[model samples]
Target chain A: MIRYVIRRLLLAIPTLLAMLTMVFVLVRLVPGDAAVSMLGDQASEQALDALRARLGLDQPIHVQYLTFLGDMLRGDFGTSMSSGRSVLSEVWQVLPYTLELTAAAMVIGVLFGLPLGTFAALYRNRWPDYTTRLLSLTGLSFPGFVSGILMLLAFAVWLRWLPVMSSASSDPLTHMRNLALPALNLGLIMTAYITRVTRSSMLNVLGEDFIRTARAKGVRPGPLVMRHALRNALIPIVTVVGLYFGTLIGNSVLTEIVFTRPGLGKLILGALQSRDYTLLQGLMVIFAAFVILVNLLTDLIYAAVDPRVSYAK
Target chain B: MTPVLDIKGLTTEFRVKNGWHAAVRGIDLSVNANETLAVVGESGSGKSVTALSTLRLLPQTGARISRGEVGFGGRDLTKLSEREMSRIRGNDIAMIFQEPMTSLNPTMTVGDQIAEGLLIHRGMSRTEAAKEARRLLDEVRVPDPARRVNDYPHQFSGGMRQRAMIAIALACRPKLLLADEPTTALDVTVQAQVLSLLDDLKRDRGMAIVFITHNLGVVAQIADRVAVMYAGEIVETATCDTLFADPVHPYTEALLKAMPRVDRKAESLEPIPGSVPSISARPAGCVYAPRCNYVQPSCAAHPSLVPVGGNHEARCPVRADKGEAA
Candidate 1:
């Protein structure tokens, strides 16, 4: 298992490098000059030239790419053009919020979706099954931002149950309250995905002969479903959850924007708008790293859930 | 001696696109202590359904026991509540299914699978159950039982998995074991080994067994008595020796004729001419009438079972009349 993890981590190097190259090129391709954006429209040509040279933006694209790669290798993401702060420090500041949102969404999704899906499968063709299917279908059809807005309106504006936006408070309880609507909005969307995958996977597992064998062995309904059916059913559900978790990390952009929360999505959006090349590139690499990390965690979870599945194997 | 299991007029139905269709017609069968009663038939002849019905393990949503009384240990199993039935299942009455490759839970260790029944019914502590599980594995003759107990199902071979399944079924020392074609998934050598293992276990424990199978050869090897099912009903039933020597029903005769014998070098093995009728599309008259060579105009009505002497019975009017005339 150690060897397997080490191999995976080693393999991620090339993948991250590729991701970093693509982000570097793509951010540069955006129709604006970073130096011009930094100095604003009133800046003289000579001033723009000086700023460009100072930021090393005047160098050839290949040379700049090499410098970026070298710095990244040396564990340095250059300072943000707008804030004059290290890109890493800026990412670190907002990293927790994004992690918190994704984690909350994931927890909510699994807690509700897993059982709902299991219930749907167990009582297939019944009212509960139909209700879950319909609910998930509705959830799937709505975009995350739209749902976030709807939740904001319903809970914060209308019901006054939750705060309208995330507050700049350090208190965990108050912070949680502020994040509730956005987290729930994203969570509901994730729940839909989890429910659909869980139901189908559960249906497949429940139909398996092992489940019948378990039943024949006089395994009661609760343990039989959970230990026998659900355990086997979890592989596909885990795959879906893991893939969605990676998506949740990057896809929180719209939800964060709608909720006006200070997170990676908002951070990256700011970088993109201000043509903060260093920060944008750094955040993209971080996102890539996160996706790779999530995939690794998912694989580990698979091994945990099923004894037959092994990273070494 | 009183039977361990007495199933009377058991009818099972599956809801189809149109309506409920009976998969197992009202059939009476019983298994006495320490005896192996083999319910033999071709596929779709309700043999598996009969076994499933006995345990009330039929698919809950689409299939159901429409009418029946499964009397086991002086209690009506059909009349038992879900909770009561659960208590009986895997405790007093255990079942092992066909498809050894898939019967055991893939994610679980074979030991835990075997120990599950012990834990639930025997109320054994986890450590005790684990030890018993190892012992059960050893009894089933799985090599390195102590180490293999921690191994998942995928690690075990098909035959070993089947043995583990048997260990699970026998873990609680159930009085009756329902084996639904348990050896069908295995090759001939493994099949023989499993059959003998089951026979030995039955002998040692004196437990009744209702072995459901499609293979006549398996029935001949392990069965004390035989019940031949066709089209959702038992067409003939007799002591194993008697049934093999003189199969009275035409379906039974056809089935016996279809067997490939090594002693005779025949051009080709004979197969029964027609397939078993579909449950939903069953004929009004005798189920085998459409396929029987001796089908007659008088064979238009379904015939009830008739005594053919010495604990043998057949559900065929023409055969019964011919026997009487002779």
Candidate 2:
């Protein structure tokens, strides 16, 4: 099994390379000139051209790609066209906050979703099942931004319990508290999805003839759910959680803008607005890598949960 | 003598959208000490429903036992609470289902399932139960009982799984064991092995057994008495010798004639003329009238079981007076 995963990871290199090529070409073709934009319109024509030449923008696209690839292999992402700072430094500066938000939201989602789903599945066609089904419907119906605004209004405006927005701060705890609402907004929707998956998977497993056999053998309900039903249900839940975790890395795009947290999402937005081409490319690359890595870890964790699954050739 | 287990006027019905439909209608049966009573019927003939109703294990949401008294050891099991019933199950009256492949948990080791009753009812420690389970496994003639006890259900073949189930049923020395076609899932050779094991276990422990199966051949071998059930009702009951030798009910006679006897048959064996009545769509009058060769005008109304001879009876009015005339 370990050998299989190692091989899969090795094979992912080409897949990642193909994605990198597509993203690189797509971003470059999109109309903004990173080198010219770096000098801004206020600068003279001469100054823009000089900056372009200095940044290797005067070269053909192929030449630029090779140089970028060489530099990337040697661990250099180049300086940001907008901020005139290292692209790598800016990414590292904002990544931790994004990680914190994603982590917090995921924990919240799992905490809320798994039990509700299990109970709903256990008492299917009953009151608890209907209640969860209703709650999930409500959760998924609202868009993230709207949900974020409403949470802000309820907690910050009426209740006046906590701050509605997040700012970059040295103290991560305060930053986390401010970030919680938007994170939970994203989490609520994910919880709805994961719960439905858990309920269906668990319900199917519980209906198997083996489950009745367990009950017949006098195994109690609690252990039967945990040992038999839940373990099997987790296979699908694992896949959903893994996909959600990968998506969380990308959540920084909209989620950060809503919460105004100084994270990768905000970084990407700033890069886009200022037209920092190098920084944008670097951030996209990092996000892709993080998602790929997180998904790999999730796959490994899923294997641990259910031994029957192994990465195929 | 008091019956080891007695089921009287047992009626189970399902609540459909329109109304209640009787699944098992007022069937009466009794098992005496060390006696084997084979309940025989085809699928949906309420054979399994009767077995499950004894423990009140029927799906309770849509299913309700309209009336019944399942008296075992002088206590009516039907009157017991879920908690009390759980305590009784695997303790006093154990049951083994038809599909041993599914009746045992796949993820759990066979020994754990076998020892489960001991742990639940006997309060046996895990270590003690494991040892006892191995011994039971060996007693059931399972190969390499000590080592194989740690193996899961998947490790055992079909025959071995049935043996493991038998080991579990016999764990607490239950007074009565309800086997719902224990050999039905096995190949012919394995079927014979399981049947002999059941016979040996019954003789050795003196435990009364209520064996439910569709195969009359199996009934002839192990059953001391046979009850033929049709459309949720027992239409005939007789000692094994008399049941196979001088069957009286038209349904019983039809079944006897349907039997493919290698020694006695000349032409192709005759099948019962019509299909067994559907449980959901039972006939208004006689359930088997559509299939009976001797359907009299009176058979338009369902006939109640009437005694015909010593320790033998059939649910046919014509058999009591008209003999075997069609």
Candidate 3:
């Protein structure tokens, strides 16, 4: 297992390099000039030239790319053009919020979605099954941002039950309270995918001969569903959940924007608007690393859940 | 002796795309203590369904026991609530299925699968159940029971897995073991080994067995009584000696002739002409009429089971009277 993990990490290096190159080139290709965007329209030509030279923006694109790579190898992501703060520090500040949101969403999704899916599969063609299907369909159809806004309106704007926007609070309880609406919004959307995957996987496992054998052994309904059917069903469900975790990390941008919660999504948006190229490139690399990490975790989870799966093979 | 299991007028149905189709028509059968009753038939003849219905383990969504009384240990299984039925399922009555490869839970260790029933029905503590699981594996003749108990189903070969499955079924020492084509997936050698194992276990434990299978060869080896099912009903039943000596029903006769023999240098094997009728499309009257060579015009009405001699019954009027096919 250790050797396998080492091999996986080694394999991730080339992927990370590729992502770095792509993000470096892609962010530069966007229409606005970083120097011009930062300095604003009122700056003189000479002033703009000085600012560009100072920021090393006047260098050739290839030279700049080489410098970026070298500096990254030395663990240096240059200072943000607008804030004059290290891009790493800025990312470090908001990293917890994104992690919190993603983790909360995952917990909520699995907590509700798994039982709903199992219920649907057990009562297939019955009213409960139909209700879950309809609920998931609605969740799938609505975008996360829209739902986030609607939730904000109902809970914060109209009902005065929760805070409208997330605050950078020190207290854990306050942070959770602030996180409720956005987390739930993202969670509900995740629940839809989770429910669908779990339902289909469960349906397949429920028909398996082992399930029948378990039932024939007079295993009660609780242990039969959880120990026999659900565990077997988890392989496919885990795949979906892992893939969606990566997606949630990247796609929580819209939900973050709607809820005005400080996260990588907000950080990236600020970088884009002010043309903080260094900060954007750094965040992109972090995001790519997160996705890779999530994939690794997913593979490990598969081995844990299924005894038939062996990393040595 | 009072039979361990007695079924009277058992009828099971599956709700298909068209409508409700009776898979197991009204049938009566019984299994006594310390005996093996083999219910033999071709596929779709409801042999497996009959076994499933007896345990009330039919699929919950589409299949159901429409009519029946499964009397076991002085209680009607069909009328029992789910909670009550559950108590009898693994404790008093256990089952093993056809596919040994898929019959055990893939995610669980074979030991845990066996120990689960002991834990549930026997009320054994985790450590006690674990010890019993290892003992059961040893009883089933699995090598290195202590080590192999921790191994998952995939690690075991087909024969070993079937042995482990038998260990699980016999974990609670149930009085009745419902083995539904348990050896069908095994090769000839392994099949013989498993059959003999079951036979030995039955004799040792005095457990009644309802062996559901499609092979008459298997029946000849392990069965004390034989029930030949066709369509969705038992067409003939008798003591194994009597049925093999003189099969009264044409379907039973045809089945025996269809068996490949090693004793005689026959020109070729006589394969049964047609397939078993579909559940949804069964003909009125006798279900085996189309396949029977002696299918007379008078065979239009379904024949109720009749006694031909001591402990022998057949569902064909013509054969019951003449004692032979014309």
Give the candidates in order of lDDT, highest first.
Answer: 3, 1, 2
Model 3 steric clash pairs: none
The runs of at least 3 residues in candidate 3 whose Cα sits more than 4 Å from the true structure, single-residue gaps closed, are B322-326
| Ten residues in sequence with the least summed lDDT for candidate 1 chain B | B317-326
lDDT of 2 by residue, A1-313 (tens): 6787787689778767876777678778869676556666688888888888888889998998888767765768788887788999998887888887787778777888888899999889999999999999888787777787788899877998768667866686876678777778778877887788889998888877667655665567787798767877787788878887666565546777877777888888888888877888888777777777877887888767764454654
Q: What is the C-alpha lDDT profile of model 1 across A51-105, one tens digit per residue?
A: 9999898999899999989998787988988899999999999888888888888
Residue A145's lDDT within candidate 2 is: 71
* lDDT score of residue A42 within candidate 3: 84
Between prediction 1 and prediction 2, which has the larger TM-score?
1
**Residue A167 alpha-carbon offset, candidate 1, angstroms:** 2.7
Candidate No. with top DockQ: 3
Off by over 4 Å in 1: B321-326
Judged by lDDT relative to the true structure, which candidate is superior, 1 or 3? 3
TM-score of chain A of each: 0.97, 0.92, 0.96
Residue B318, model 3: Cα distance from true site in angstroms: 2.6
**TM-score, model 3 to reference:** 0.96
* Chain B alone, TM-score, model 1: 0.97
CA lDDT, candidate 1, residue A99:
84
